[model samples]
Target: MDSSRGTRIRRRVTLFLLLLVASSLVGTSRAREAQPLPTAAAGGGSRRAPERHGLSLDFYAKTCPAVDQIVASVTAARYKDFPAAGPAVLRLFHHDCFVEGCDASILIAPTAAGAAASAAPTVERDMEENKNLPQEAFDTVELAKAAVESKCPGVVSCADVLALAARDYVQQAGGPYYPVKKGRKDSKVSLAGKVRGSLPRSNSTVDELLRVFAGKGLGTADLVALSGAHTVGFAHCVHVLGRIYDFRGTRRPDPLMDARLVKALRMSCPSSGGSARVVVPFDVSTPFQFDHAYYANLQARLGLLGSDQALSQDPRTRAMAQELAGNKTRFFQAFVASMDRMGSIRIKKGRKGEIRKVCSQHLLAV
Candidate 1:
C-alpha cells in the first residue's frame, strides 16, 4: 500500500479503539454510581446467582473451615476460661476492618517517620496488645489455620480466614448480616510500612481520610460509615491525649460537650503523651457492641480521632449517624451499605496480581 493509504488505515483503527475504551469507561461509571445491593438467594430472577459457575467451592471450603474452628475455639476459651478478653478481641477486628473490607492491616507497626527511621525497630507494645485489648485474636487465628492444615492439609489462605473471622466477629456482636466473597489469597509480602501508610491514624484529618478513600475510588458516605467502627474500640493515651491536653488550641473539644466529662477525660488522659494511665477506650461504656454508640459518643464531643469528629460537623453524615444511633435496623442497613462501598475500593487483581500464601508476609513462590 502507498504511505498515505497505510496512514489512513492506522488512523481509523486508533479512532475505533478510542471509542471502545470510552464506551467501557462510561458503563463502569454508571454501574458504580447505581451501587445496587445484591438480593437474597430466594429472590431469584434474571439477576445472576451469588456464586459464579467457574469459582471453586472446594477452595472456599478449604479456606473457610479453619475460620469456623477458630471462632469456635475462641468463643469457648473466652466464655469458659478468659471471658474478659473475648469482647475486646471481637471488637478489635470489627473496628479495624469494618471500613475497608477487613484487611487485617491494622495490626502492622507504624512506619518510622523520617530521620529517626534508622533507629532500632521495636513494636509499640501498648498499641497492639495493650491491657485493654488482647493479642490472642491474631495468634489464635494462625493456630486455628495450623489445626486446619493438619486435617485438610494446607488448603486455606489466611486472607480468607481473616475475612471470615471479621464477618463472624461483627455478627456475634449484634451487627449487620455480612456478605463476603472468599478466595482472597494471603499476601506473603508483609510490608509494615505500607500497611501503616494505608490505615488512618489517630490525628488524621477528615480531608486526609477523604483523599485516602478517593484514591481507592470511594466517596464521602463510605468514609463516614467506616468511621462508625469507633463504636467498638478504644484509643490509647498516645492516640487521643493530644486533643485533650496538647490540642492545638483550634481543635479543642467542642463547647457543647459536658464540661465535667471533658475535665474528667483530660484528667484521666493526662497530657503525658502516650501515658498508660490516661488511655481511654473509644466507646468508653460499651466497647464491645456494634451499635450507634460511636455516633452517640461523637454527639457528646467524645470522638477519639480527628476523622471521627469530622462526621458530626458534616451536614450529610451527622443526620445519618444520629438516626442510626436511635434505630437498630437503620444502623444495620447503613452498616451493610457502607461496608459494601468500602469493600469495592480498588484492589490488586487479574494477571498482574499474585495469590499470596501468607497473610502477614509476602506471597510465596507460585
Candidate 2:
C-alpha cells in the first residue's frame, strides 16, 4: 500500500477501537443506573451505614403485633385534644435521639435516690437545652407507654414507642408518614450533663448547626430537610428575641429578615418586659401544618430561628433551602430520609440498653 493509504488504515483501526471501548463503558453505566436502589432492609440507599442494629420495619411483628396501632391511637387522641402535641412529640424524639441515640433517656425523671447520689442530680429532662421540651411531649410518651405496657408488658421499649409516636404525630399534623424501624432500647443512663452541647441552639450559625448535625453523620441536605419540622412547631419568644430586636447586638433587627416579619415579631416578642412564656408559630403562613412553608419562610426571611434562616443565607445550604421551598413532595421525601438516618444514630443493642416499664422511671426504680 502507498504510505498515505497505510496511515489512513491505521487511523481507522484506532478510531474503531476507541468507539468500541466507549460503547462498552456506556453500557456499564446504564446497567448500574438501571439497577434497583437498595431499600431500608438492604441499607444501601442512604449515606449512613446499613441496618446492622437489629432494627426492622416489623421488629414487633410477632412479639406485640398491635404496638403500632396502640401508639398511634394514643398519639391521635392527645393530638385531637391539644394540637401542640404533634410538634411537642416530634421535638421530644429529636432531643432524645441527639443526646443519647434515640434511647428515650429524655423521658427519665429525677429521683430522690439519684439526687442523694449526686450533689445536684439532674436527668436529661432537666438540662437547660431540654427545659423547654414541653410537658405535652412527656405526657404523650407516658400515655403511649402505659397503653403499651398494659398489652405487651415488657415486650415494647420506650425508645421504640417514642419513635413510633413521633412518626404518628408528624403524619397526623399533615406531614409525610414514614416507616420507623424498631428494636431500639431505652438508655440506662440519663445524665443532664450529656445534653449540654448535643442540640443546636436557636441562634446557632450555619457552621455551628452543620457541625452539630455532622457529628451525627448527617450532611447539609439532611440538616435543612429536618429543619422543616419547624413548619408545625412554635418557638418561644426568648428564642427569637435577639433576631427581631438587636441582632448580634447591632441595635437593629437582622437585615436578612423581611421588614414585615420584623414588625410582626416585635408585636409578639417585645424587646423588654415580654412574658417569657409567650410563643409564636415557626411558620406564620401555615402554623399548624407540616409543609414546605418553613423553607418558603426562610426564603422570605421569615424564619423564626436564626439557625433556620441561616440555611437560606449560607451558600452551602441556600440551594437546598430554595429547592425544598418550591417542592413540598421533594421536601417530604428528604425529611423522611433524614429522619431515618437520624433515628439510627448511635443505637444501643445487646445489654447496653433496656426496655423501661415506665418511660419516666428506670426499670430498677419501677
Candidate 3:
C-alpha cells in the first residue's frame, strides 16, 4: 500500500472511533433525561427528610469548627503513605453504615459488658462478613479521631469523624468533593449477630441487591451508583472462588465473566487449595482510580464479582450501567446523592448515642 493511503486509512479509523464515542454519549444523555430521580420509601411511603435527623453540612460549625480540616489532614497524610487507605476507608464507611446505621458501631471492640449481654461476646468487626476489612481503614479512623480529640476533645463524635474521613478519602482519590452532613453519634451496641442479613454478598443477583438496598431506604440508582466504589479496592479469593471455579455447581466458571478474566483469575485462585488471602482488583483497568471505569468493565463483562456484572446483565439496570459508563459527570453526581442518603440511615442523636473519646471502645467500657 502507498504511504499516503495508509495515512488516510489511519485518520479515517480515528474519526470513526471518535464518532462512536460521541454517539454513545448522546444516547446516555437521552436515557438520563427520560428517567425520573428515585426517592426512598418506607412501606410504600416517602422517607423522612435527612434534615429531620438533625444532620447538617455545618453541624460542627460552632462546636468543632476545625473538624473537617482535621479529618482531611489526617486522611491526606495517611493516604500519601498508603494509597490503599482510600478504598479501605470507603469500604469501612459502607460497612459501618449498612449495619446499625452510620453510627460507627463497626469500630467498637468487644467488651465484657457487651459480651455478658449477648449469647456470644463478638463485636461487629470480628464478624465473618467484616473480617476482611483492612487495618488501614481502622487506623485512618483512629488517627483522625485522635487529631480531632487533640483540638476539640469530646466535641466530635467518632461517627462524624468516620463520615468526614470517608468523604475526604473519596475526594483525595479523584472522586467528587461532596459535603458530609455531621452530628452522628457512636452507637453503644455492636453485636456480631446483627451482621448476617444486613450486607450484600459477592454473588448476589440484581434483584437480591435491590431488595437489600430497598430495606435500607435506598433505591436501585443508589445501589448501582454505590457499586461504582468497586472502581477501586479489591476482593479476596475466597469471595470469587465459587464464581471462577464451579459457578453454582455448573462445574465451570461463570459465563458472565470475560474469558480472559476467567483465565487470569484461575491463575491466582486455582480450583483446589488456593490461598484464601489472595486478592484481585475489582476493576482491572485502573483499579486504583475512583471513576466510571467500573461501569465500563461491567459492559465488557470484565466485572470481577458476580453481583457487579449483574448490573449490566439484568434488564432493569443495564441502561443505567451504560449511561454511567458513558457519562462520568452523571455517575459522580449520583454517587454524591447516594452517599448523602446512605450517610443518613437511622442516625443516632440526643440521648440515644454518645460522643466517645476513643473510637474503638465504648465510653461505658472505657
Could you tell me the TM-score of candidate 1?
A: 0.65
Where does candidate 3 clash, by residue pair? none
lDDT of 2 by residue, 1-366 (tens): 124532543353344334434434111100111122123222112344423486899889999999999999998888776777789899999999888688888899866665475785678877778878888789889999999999999989999999999999899989998899999988989998888888999999887886777667677767888899998877888998888889888999989877766776776678999888767777766667887888877766677788888888888777777777777787898889889988988888879999999999888888
Candidate 2: list runs displaced more than 4 Å: 1-52, 112-120
Tens-digit lDDT track of model 3 for 271-293: 77877766677877666678888
Of the candidates shown, which would achieve the greatest lDDT relative to the real structure?
Answer: 3
Query: What tens-digit string does per-residue lDDT give for candidate 1 at 148-181?
Result: 5555555555544554555555666667756555
Computed on alpha carbons, the lDDT of every model, listed in order, comes to 0.49, 0.79, 0.81
List residue ranges in candidate 3 displaced over 4 A.
1-52, 111-120
Q: Per-residue error at 158 for model 3, in Å? A: 0.8
Alpha carbon lDDT at 123, candidate 1: 30
> How do the predictions measure up, each by TM-score?
0.65, 0.85, 0.86
Candidate 1: global Cα-lDDT? 0.49
- Please give the ranking of all candidate structures by lDDT, highest first, separated by commas: 3, 2, 1
Ranking by TM-score: 3, 2, 1
